[model samples]
Target chain A: MIQKWKNHAEAYLFVTPSVILTVTLGIYPILWALRYMFYDYKGYGEAKFAGLYNIKRLFRDDYLWDAIWNTFVFASGKMILTLPVALLLAVLLNGKLRGRNLLRGIYFMPTIFSTAVMAVVFYLIFNSYNGLLNQILNMIGLPAVEWLNMQNAMLTCIIIAAWGGIGNYMLLFLAGLQGIPKDVYESAELDGATGARRFWSITIPMLGPVLNIIMMLAIMSALESYEAIMVLTGGGPSGATEVMHLYLYKLLFPVSTGETMAQDIGYGSAVAMLLALIVGVITGLYLYLSRKLNDIYS
Target chain B: MTRISGRILTWTFLLITAALLLLPIALAMLGSFKTNQELNAGSALLPKVWQLENYLYTWKEAKFSVYVWNSVIYSVGATITTVTVCSLAAYAVARRSFPGRKLLLGVYSAMMFIHMGVLTLKPAYQIMVTLGLHKSVLGLIIMMTGAGGTTFFILYAFIRSISKELDEAAMIDGASSFYIFSRIILPLCAPALGVVGLFAFRGAWNNYILPLVFTMSQPELQPITVGLANIRYGFGGAVQSHLMLTGACISMLPMLLMYILANKSFVQMNVGAIKG
Candidate 1:
């Protein structure tokens, strides 16, 4: 009985520190943010009860709607480009070819750099007059394009994101590929299933679990993306690239908006709750899909 | 003949894609070593003369050394806190047959989906003010330790992979669970810890938003990422590409060097993460 009590104490002791930090830092802030949704308060002002006013204001905010639409465009654009390229790269690296490790290392290089730093490097490379892309274009006797203009701002951001992100996802897919038993491929080969047919039949089905995991992660990240957009365009070329999170950040901080520097903590929280609802839906889908995949796997 | 042709096609495609992906980095590295005159001449692929002075200028003008040290402190502090705290909790749930193990595991699993993103910023900022942790790098590290969302699950899965018999045998020897955890489990889980450390350090080092938001008024306390971003847009307004690229290169140098040294392990760690 003494030993049982000791075991319980020991276990609780081991887990308590982490639970405290997680609750204080991660969980509590979220609850606090939710609490702010019902009050109309700025940073230093008194919290006046303005029930549902923030929510009503959120519905009428065109900028918020625009930011949401732009975020969707950015996230979808990133997903559409990132997944196939990462899968293709993973497949290429999975082959028993010479210098595969070297190629893999090179491919994964971009994933390691700071996104802000990479954004700057990309900014230089895509510069309108002195950029590498335009220089190449001029050399090839072609017209130079305004890559960071309002129309192309989001596209440029997507391209930059894909360049840096493909490596991490490719590694995930490669791990999944390596887990597949070789005998499956050999038996398929015995039946004369070669190339695309073999890949479509065996590899794709085998990678389904990892694919779902990556898809969930990719969507979550693409939605939460701020650093690259902040560094590259600051959600600009005339707010063409303002994402939901960036807009929320602007609302919370309110740095450069001279008179608008009055921090609207409540309204910002309302906007954030709406975005969180979207993320929550996606998270539910991901959870449901993961359980289904686990069921299939088992 | 078809086999040979297919192999060639695959190689060609891989090489082209690799080149395309790496070209921007290559341009930055090359441009960093060139003169402004050379950059203006459009000789971007290779430097006519390696201007090492650009690095020196950036290091001094941008206060790279201070930012580098700040980043090292924050990243290392955060990584240690995460690995120690999360591994301890992971071990409890993974090994010990305790009362709340199931509940703790459920909580962590649910927390995985609630990323919270920028929603935590307002409340976190307010909390930091109340606790007097704002405007300092250590405060940011404290915030990071709290945000170990996926890291906890990854470490838990890793701890679960270790054999149960070891813990049982250690218990039979009258060894305390803490002794077994500290002496037996942690050392055995060194490889996972390395993976966690790499991730923790890299995430903190590359983190831009938290540092930017926290260190908004305190420029001197900023890390290299914030420093480089500020120089590019704020301080180094209308600056030459060579100098701007130099700052970017300096920010990337540490991770690049780490990758070069442990290329194999980095790849394995990334792959190991997903295999969980």
Candidate 2:
């Protein structure tokens, strides 16, 4: 009994720090955030018994709805562009071309830089007057356009996200490609399966699991994208690029504009909870379907 | 002749794609050395005169030194804590058949999904306040170390992949569990540790939201991400784009240098997911 107790103690001792910190920082805050969903408070202010008021406010809040719409558009836009481009790059770099490793390294460079830094740089590049893109346009005798205008802001954010992100996904896809046995491709080629045919028939089937993971990652990252939009546009040109996380930040920290945006923790928590639920449902559904697909594969 | 042309075509396509991908970063590097006036009077990609003084101006004007040190501290502190704590926990879970071992692994894997997003801000702040970690760089590092995400799962897999007979051999010689862990398991897991260290470093270094929230009142404590955002918002329309680009390049330098030095290991990170 004592030995069993000691084993248990040792196990607990080994795992205690991680478990405590994860619970404190991860699980506890989530539960706490959920708790804040019910009460009315302004971040540090006193809580009042205002059940579901925040949710009701959220339901009627058009700006919240607009932010939600913009987020989906942004996430979908990023995934749509990023995955295919990454796959193409991965395929190109996966070959026995000269300087393949050098090309791959260059492609993967953007993944290392801070998003805020890149976004700031891109903001300058996309600046209305003296930006690089505009300079190029003018040199070619085209008029300078506002890239961060209401119609174009989300697209600009999407492009920047894709530019910084494709490298990482491409690396993942390259690894996935390399994992396939040479014999599989050789056999396919011997049977006259070449180029697009080989890619579809052999490569795609083999990369099933990796593709699922990449897709899931793309979805999750896109959904939670805040930094790119926040740094580049500040959800500006009339809130065109405001993603859900930025909306949540604006709720709590209300970026000062002389006329203060309300700092309501309760409302922010409710919106955050709703956003979390949407992400959760989408993730859960994806996982469920992917598991079913895995069963079929097995 | 057809085959030769095909090779040239493929090479040209790859070259163009690489150039397009690298153009923004190259522009930032080049533009950082230009005068603000040259940047303004510009259709030129190349600066008329290389203003190496732009670096010094950005360093002083933007307080780049303070933010760089803060970033280094956060990345190093968080990386060490995360790697140490996570490797210890991962070893315990992956090796030992203890009570609640499965339960522990399940919790870690479950967190791999179910991202609560920024909703944790209020309570995270509260916890920081209670622990007097708010507005402190150390607090931000602690919060970062608490993220038992990809690193934990990857380390768990890495530990599991090692042979069990090694542990048995150590036991036969009367080595303690801690001794075996320190001497045998850790050294074996160095490659995995390197990958985790890189990831932890990048995550802490690039993290904008947590540091932004934690170091709101303490400007000096903020990392480069928050610092750059401050420069963007504070100056609004009046801020010189060239100066900001110089700051951006400054922020990119360490990561770029690390990647260049350890290019092989950086590419090897992708395999971690495939193994998992």
Best by lDDT: 2
Model 1 iRMS: 1.8
| TM-score for each of the candidates | 0.94, 0.95
Candidate 2 C-alpha lDDT tens digits along B133-156? 787777888888944777888898
Candidate 1 chain B, run of 10 with poorest lDDT:
B144-153
What do the candidate models score in CA lDDT, each in turn? 0.83, 0.84
True contacts kept of 2: 0.69
In model 1, which regions exceed 4 Å deviation?
A256-262, A286-298
Which window of 10 residues has the lowest lDDT sum in candidate 2 chain B? B267-276
Compute the interface RMSD for candidate 2. Answer: 1.6
Question: Per-residue alpha-carbon lDDT of model 1 for A1-298, expressed as tens digits?
Answer: 9989888899999998899887877788778878988999887759998999999998899989999999999999998998898999898788777998888898899999998889888887777776778888888889989999988889999999899888888888898898889899899989999779988989988877777777888898899887788777878877899998888878887773222435788888888878988888976787797888779966
Q: Which sections of candidate 2 miss by over 4 Å?
A: A255-260, A289-298, B1-9
Highest DockQ: which candidate? 2
Provide the TM-score of the second chain in candidate 2: 0.95
